[model samples]
Target: MTESDDIRSTLIDMLEELDDRLARITDDVKHTQEPLAKDSEEQAIPVENDEVLDYLGNSTRTETDQVNRAIAKLEQGHYENCEACGEHIAKERLEIVPFARLCVRCAEKSEE
Candidate 1:
């Protein structure tokens, strides 16, 4: 299969995994609304639980957004190029992060 097809498949897999994780996070936070005695003991701080849930929610949103952007790039016919420098992103990097938007050099520069 072509590299585009492989990355497309990877993005699909990541999206599915994210969906499952978000669902589980939702379930975990929802059930804690009325914590049982054992659960209450296990979770000494309700605020901590809330914080964890919030963090997970934010992380899930970010990942979902990235995955969607990757899929859009794939559809737009430039999934292999860096959005910032118009250079081809390394295949190795794309294999690791299929939604990457910058080549290594540009990405490193942007970090500065």
Candidate 2:
């Protein structure tokens, strides 16, 4: 397979693994919530379970969406090209962040 195809496959695998891990974490957290609540007083700062769950859930959703979007971009003949300059993104960077939409130069300039 080509490099972009390889990257896409790896990212798909990573995202699926993340989804499984997040589901397990969510269930474990839910199971612990009741015991945690029973011991803590109401006035004791709320454990912020909702906030934590929301953050974790949103993160997983966003990551899944991003992975799908990246794959779509690949199919549409745009993979590895910087969105801003249309230059090929370095393979090293792509290896680090398979969903990257910008090359290092464009990304660096944007941070200014």
Candidate 3:
């Protein structure tokens, strides 16, 4: 298969995995499978776990959005260009992070 096709497949797989994780996190945070403990002390553990799950859910959702955007860019024939500086993104970086929108330098700067 062509490189873009391979990358598209990888990104789709990542998106599916992230979606599954987000669903599980949502279910856990909502206590849908089991009710919260009646004992206050026992309840604290699940509450703390829910906080972590919430954070993970948010992170997964963000990644899912990025993957979707990357897929769109790939289809538009603009996937390899950095969003910030319009430079060509390194193939190595793309291999590692197919959903990345910025080059290393621009990404570093954005973190500041």
State in Å the error of residue 21, model 2. 2.9
lDDT of each: 0.88, 0.80, 0.89
Task: List CA RMSD, all candidates.
Answer: 2.3, 2.9, 1.9
What lDDT tens digits, residue by residue, belong to model 2 across residues 1-112? Answer: 9876687788789788878978976886776465444555753543566677768888888888877877888888887889899999998997888888899999999999
Name the TM-score of candidate 3: 0.88
Give TM-scores for every candidate, taking all chains together and pairing residue i with residue i: 0.87, 0.75, 0.88
- Model 1 — TM-score against the truth? 0.87
Best by lDDT: 3
Q: What lDDT would candidate 2 get against the real structure?
A: 0.80
lDDT of 1 by residue, 1-112 (tens): 9877877888999999999999999998888787568745666777788899989989998989999998998999988889987989998998888889899999999999
Model 2 scores worst on lDDT over the 10 consecutive residues at 37-46
Better of 1 and 2 by TM-score: 1
Model 2 C-alpha RMSD to native = 2.9
